[model samples]
Target chain A: MSRLSGTGLTLAYDKRVIAEQLSVEIPDGSFTVIIGPNACGKSTLLRALSRLLKPAAGTVLLDGGDVHSLPTRTVARTLGLLPQSSTAPDGITVAELVARGRYPHQGLLRRWSERDEQVVTESMAATGVGDLADRNVDELSGGQRQRVWIAMALAQQTPLLLLDEPTTYLDIAHQIEVLDLCAELHERQGRTLVAVLHDLNHAARYATHLIAMRDGKVARSGPPGEVLTAALVEEVFGLPCRVIDDPETGTPLVVPAARRKTSVQAEV
Target chain B: MSKVMVIRPRAVVIGAGALLAMTAVAVLTLGTGDFPIAPADVVKTLAGQGNAAQTFIINELRLPRVVTAILVGMALAAGGAVFQSITRNPLGSPDILGITSGAGAAALAVVILGGSSTALSLAAITGGIGTALLIQLIGGRRGLQGYRFILIGVGMTAILNGIMGWLLTKGVQMENARALLWLAGSFDGRGWEEALPLLGVLIVTIPILAVVCGPGLRMLEMGDDVAAGLGVPVKRLRNGALLVASLVVACAAAAAGPVNFVALIAPNIARRVTRAPGPNLLPSMAIGALLTVAADWLAMHSGYPLPVGVVTGGLGGAYLVWLLISERKAGRI
Candidate 1:
């Protein structure tokens, strides 16, 4: 499997520096989730790693070569990214949308082939969107639409997939549904999955490799059991919380500590 | 869980059907003029074997006008489709982008300032390109997203219209009247001098457009970030589409004097008719051709002999209003 890593990277947008001298390696065949507070540069780091945002310094390497120096379509054939939000074109069917992911593999003379058809079919089946293949994307519910989007990413047939805040606008149930799908894709297929997630507890529950970020730096990086703790949660999020085992999964679950009233405030 | 990727049959049918309709419309319109000739004679003369009167009517009088309508329809519709798909807004057409108005302003200036047909064509093309480049420089850094680009385009259009109004009022009566007829988009005196150059530009543009529409436009509908991730050279694709669209609009406006609403309405009409998922470039072009030819026929045959632009503007404005109401009802706005 090709290894993906970024070393000694300086990430920036225009003039404002987001992260300086940041280095990280994504472990092979693991569900790696990066968690951070709002504007902590988690998404920025993901963007750099995915080659959506070029680093101000250092290199993003796929295998041994510099990713930026590689042919963009070649890099795309290896790594696929699902952005947070993408609007469906009017009246587009799920199959047609997913078929677009085959673009990187297609050449000018070689348009859609039989293999493209098979891959698209397999991707829809894998994402459990086969039944919705003929349905217009706008008619589907939010969770279904997200799945269709993921199916499109899967249709790219890349081994390494990165998602930036895949569960952002989704409600609790839908969030869990998407995470469950991601976990299944990782564990079943042995593909490297990197996602930037907002909820710490959800990240701990789903991610095999957890990266906790604070102030443009990785505060903790390890397995969920080793890295997630009450003290770390308090330090990272500035919220006093107790970390306990999840009843169903035995992963770390954070419970916020209740605020106590002082004597003067209580009297008033 | 068995599913297959399939091409849309409806779109193919619609495309072929529109082409057939355009052929019929073109032939019919070619035959309906001051000295009316039969459709048989129109085709016979087009094939370079006809009587002297038939040859004169087809070759000298009606052929260029028909050819101009066809080319303008093609350019504006295809250009509109490109703009709409890139901007991801149904209302995002060359007319909305201030391109047509800019061309109109330049063409008017050329008319008043005393220029040849070729000079006027060249100036109009430059003006459209200038306006498009200005829009790109100002609000296009982020790509054509949200209201900013459209708003800026509207402002520019207003300013250009203001300039055009000033030019018309300050100019002499004969020139002003001639400018007004041009602004209303007449095919009354258009000839091979205009049609030949536009055909040359189209010969280059249409193939490039066909090549890009598949991957470039398909990726674009997925949004810029996803498009980039899919290995589409996003900036290059966008710039290419913009250039092609701008050039076509310039060429069409130069030929037909900024005929209103065909660019704005044809792409949307094609989409609705074909029910295609992505950008309907070919279908839109066909629809544009048909709409323009049909409108020209109506304008000439309307007893008072109105300009083609008047008919298109009136019909297209009504269509726009209907679209607004429908979109609002569907909660798209």
Candidate 2:
């Protein structure tokens, strides 16, 4: 069974509705990817699932209990979240940044434990930031900084994880490094993942289940092979496309239609 | 595991060590008066068994002064750190929020109207808290973005200063001299009568500082959305910090008259020394005490009888310039 499910969910900012009558179930241990154009409510839906945003009409349930009513630490213990960017205090080391993920577990009289250290170390190693632990987070490269954030999320030691636009602003190599790490986390660590992604190719390649959203609605939901058709891409994105199987992995590939700027005489 | 456990304990250990150093330096702070005492005799006086003349010099006179310095320092710095955390600004302090301005005017009113000392303290506390509230109302919910609160506070401070200046000019010489009692911030001429009242506030406020402000501060630093998402009651935390900060400044100012900049510089320095976001409160208290004691020593013994506020106020302005230049260099401001 999936750990997080939003039912009959309607989300909006103030009075402007972003997603209406929305419903989704993020499967346990499954890499689920949400892909859509900008302003398509993908991030909003993710926030609703993560309990960061309140749904206007319905509730997000965690294992059959309302997430809002459950203690924040309880939800945090079960589900970890990595926002697009995290702010760190000045001169804060990567290790310290990661250690903050253990805050929900700490208290006034309680002390740090070997288990916390182990979790923090393993998270850093898993995210390939083990060597960068002592370095200041703000001084690191964008890619390295992102890894430090992931290490923080991993340090949370949650069974389910949600990420919003985790690949934004990265070059091709760094993008793959991030996605590949996410893939490793899903494949090896068996952590449930729900990510909002812009790159459909990356989404199809990594996602076990894909949900393509459009104009405040889920346009299609299924395995990538059947749901991610050229027709569906054109309808959802308002762009024409050609679909083909990926050479590296057998998943739908989307190529958008383009217009020639010049006719034959103009080109001449 | 060992490292993590070790660092927290070390912060406390080093904090206590700083406290001890401050106490020893405080001993030097004594004997700064016209008649000096031997260090051993000062210690003997401190232990409550010394010769009569030394006892009168140290216990009857200097001891209360030292305690006053410690109380003012702790009150201002600890209050500043809490306010800065909740507001998420390096510049936030009780004085910057117009608390001191209100206290000054209120204390002036008490003296001009011949209010009792206890009534005077009450009036000052109420006035200080009210002024802080007034600034927050004018500045609104976006406290730090445009320096609106600070600018508004400077205006309030100027108004209060004008009122104090006018009141001083209006009085007869003897009345003016009595009014002047509140003007120069001093540990001079104080006794346990002054220290005792402050002790009550310290006992009530310090535990509240430990239990309430510490955790809520961490949440406040990450912005409202993130803090609220983390389940910190953001509004409550902010308002509580403001309330506590107001009370602290008012009580300290009532006890010692205003001592400037210990609040501003102490927390900033403590944060740097600890390498943490908000100043570690305990260390900040220790540092504040050191700063006040140091300033008092300079005030009493620096070849002239300067008010401690003059030294500290000058220090605060220079620090402001330094912070501005450094921030401009770093491209943060």
Candidate 3:
């Protein structure tokens, strides 16, 4: 089993520090979701773990080896990342965009191979973008575009995958659709998955391992049923809310407290 | 055997056709200059069998000019394609990024300071790299994102153009005429001395671009974070690509004095015509060669006898206006 861990990380962008001495361990073959409010450093942690943003101190370890010290292509072969925002080049076909994921496996003289084509096709098929292979990526809908981007990441064929806010900019149905795809990829493909999601309910429902963060620190890290509580919700989000079992999956569902009637009457 | 080649049939066909057109233009350019040698004589002279007059005309007088035009066009177009790919915008050519103007400014300084042509060429290269570094610094760590890079480049170009104008105003008649002709990017009186520097740069840089950097540009088109995630050394690759692009543009500027609009328009034309998903480096170079050769031919034979840069500049300016309106409509501006 491959291990992905970030230990004693001190993260900063320029002089502004975001996290100090932060450590995280992703459970193998589990779908881990990090949930936090905006500016809480959830995405920043993901970036560090995926080697997008180097930690100021400490290291991200993959299989007990420092990710930064290893050859980038080797690390990339073991891990894949789908960032929060990916802009599709103008007039690029869906197939072409997905094929770019094979960069790590290619070289100046080694070039594209049959294995690359096969993997790209399978990835597109898995993400349900096979039908749109010839269509321009810029012409796709938001949901379709997101799926294509995921397809590109999947084409890397890494054992571990990290996604940042993968469900953002999607409506309720599309959000569920993408989350469902991620769940399927985790459960069926048996790959380790880590994602930073904004919605607590979606994270609770889809995440096998959930990590709730507040102010760049982990508030709780455990199974959703064990970690998600009304008290913790109030503590992290500063919202008075009830945590209950979801009807469909029995995961935690949050319902915020209603406004006081006295305050409304006073307004009147 | 492992599969090592990815072929684009459309680009190949388009490139071949462009090459054929360029060859025809080259023959016409050689045969019609000054004394009017026949096309057969030009071909025979190229094959080392023409009479002294035909040989001298084709080999000495006309061949160098045609070669300079083709090489400069190819270099500019290739550089433009690389810049546009790195920036992920069709408008981000070397001309727009202030590279050509930087080279022109340095070349003008050389001329005004009474330096030799060798000094001018070397200074032009140095100027391009320096200006590109300045733009990169001003654009900050975001590299060429949004309109920031273009805006910074425009500011740099304005400053360089001011210096060039001042230099022109300060020079005497003979020197001013020479400087003015160079600024207008004429192919007249250009010989092997000018062609050699550009040829050497192209020989070294073009292979690096086409074989190694070109493929990585596809990943770059997906944004920096994603490109980094895909195992591309984004900063290193971006910097290297920028350096190569700057050098190529500088060499072209040194050879042909800031030939306007070839770098700006060639890549876009190649992209539209070939419709390739990745960077159209080769096709763009071919298109650039054709456009420059055709423009030079028109410049020589158009009765009014304008500089080659005038035609490209006028046409490119019109295209720029159309592009701005279209981009505005598309909400990209």
Candidate 4:
């Protein structure tokens, strides 16, 4: 069963249509990863689902109601999104930045409360940024900064979280660290996690549900073991590859075909 | 790590200090002049204990000008804080962004065309709102963000300044002299007529800014996507803030003839003093009142009297140059 789903969503910016008649569903309590080639409308779909981009046609339903029709704050209390890039206000501390996530729950009369303070503390600790609370966000490393941003989303305390290319700018180790944190949130906290990722192997290894896209359409989606076959990868990503089981996790992994040795050589 | 407190004690202390300083300047300003009432006498007169002559001087002659200065300063600073926060740029105050220039040009037009003071005020407000809408239209539908909006505003300011200079040239000798004095931004001959209107604007706008828009604007500094993801109505909030800020800048311009840099410098100074990020609206308003009152006092006491605008213009110009140099050194520009 799924609590968040889209039906016939047509997403566009200005006059340029990125996708038409697209539909998707995020399973309840699953770590879902979406992977596709560049400009395949993966991020557009995520934006539509998160209600950042209003769909030109059709609807995104959250809990059997149109998400766009609901009050924004009400939707925010149930769902959170970490955008691809967000600027930290200059001279902001890690704790202050995380505490801003409690905005939806706060109001003019209802200022910051003890619950807000406790939530901010726990969010920072969950993302291993408790010690960096007093440090400036500008002074943190890329990996630590990413963790702080995730901690902010965690502070929102939404049951459903969507991240658009959360690991895009990080080193490989940081990418894996972030993915591990997402996986932990899904497994231990039973939060529904949907993320767009570039690394196919990581997506396959970590995602309980995998979605592959091509030309603004979902080419295949299911359990990673069922959806991440060599044929679907070749069709979706246009890469000639062989699929093999990962030794440690027993999940399907792709190995690109080796290029033939060139016979023509330039004279030195 | 130590617990991070939501409220900063330093900001509260600085706010209190600024309020006290403003009160001191107000009292001192009321006491100085050719009549030269003592500060103690000024306080007593304010409390209804003064002699008839002292009461007439304090109540009738000088008090209105001081009130106008305070209200104009608060309006300008509040407007500046809103614009800077919205654009996320320190250089995005009303004066730099052409908002005051728009009001100045309209007020100049009314003066040159022999309009009443009431017409002048209304015209200034219309001009300010029109300029904001023009900038918004040209800035495109992407909403107010980044350096693009600031650059467009800078361009608009240049155009409006040229218009103002041309308008000044068209007036007759007597009208030209009057327009020039107004352009220099003086408190001479100002009375309850000017102060009351500004007070009305403040009463209407300040509460809305504090209670409705403050928290959402703070969220907007993180970027639009993050703000929207947190459920802030981004477009509506930006437009509403721009409208309120334009009204403020226009009203202050009508009262004080575009008093140079209180709007540009007050919020920046408040942010530095408080050592807090975001708009710093209340502190900025307090510091603004202090700066204007202090500048007016200096203008009155200087061996050669000058318009209050000249004092602020010289100081603000220097501050601008220093800010540019420091921002360049910091690699922010």
TM-score of chain B of each: 0.95, 0.92, 0.96, 0.97
Residue B240 C-alpha lDDT in model 3: 92
B222-274 in candidate 1: lDDT tens per residue? 78999988998888888878888898999999998988989999999999988
How much is the lDDT of residue A245 in candidate 3? 89
TM-score for each candidate, following the candidate numbering = 0.95, 0.88, 0.96, 0.96
- Top model number, DockQ: 4
The deviation in Å at residue A6 for candidate 2 is: 3.0
Q: Model 2 has how many clashing residue pairs?
A: 0
Using lDDT as the measure, name the better of candidate 1 and candidate 4. 4
C-alpha positional error of residue B211 in candidate 4 after TM-score superposition, expressed in Å: 1.6
Candidate 2 per-residue C-alpha lDDT over B1-333 given as tens digits, one digit per residue, 9 for 90 to 100: 332232455557667876887888799888667788877778888898988888888887888889988888888888887766665556777777668878878887788877788877888888888887887777756544346666777788888888888877777777667667566676777678878878788788877876666765665565554444444555666777778778888888888777787777887877777776544788888888888888888888778778888888888879978977986898766
Off by over 4 Å in 2: A8-21, A262-268, B1-17, B105-113, B131-184, B219-235, B302-304
Encode model 3's per-residue lDDT on B115-184: one tens digit a residue. Answer: 8988988888898888888898889476687788888888889999999989888888788788888989
Off by over 4 Å in 4: A263-268, B1-4
lDDT of 4 by residue, A1-268 (tens): 4889999999999999999999999999999999999999999999999999999998999988899899888888899999996999877899999999999999889988888999999999999999999999999999999999999999999999999999988999999899999999999889999999999999999999998999989999999999999899889988989999999999998999888556664332
Please report the TM-score between candidate 3 and the true structure: 0.96
Cα lDDT tens digits, model 3, A1-268, are 3499988999899888999988889999999999988898999999999998889998999999999888888888899999987888777788888888898888877877788988988899899999998888889999999999999899998989999999989999999999999999998899899999988899999999999988888889999998889999988999899988899999999988887689769899
Error of 2 at B259 (Å): 2.0
Off by over 4 Å in 1: A262-268, B1-7, B40-50
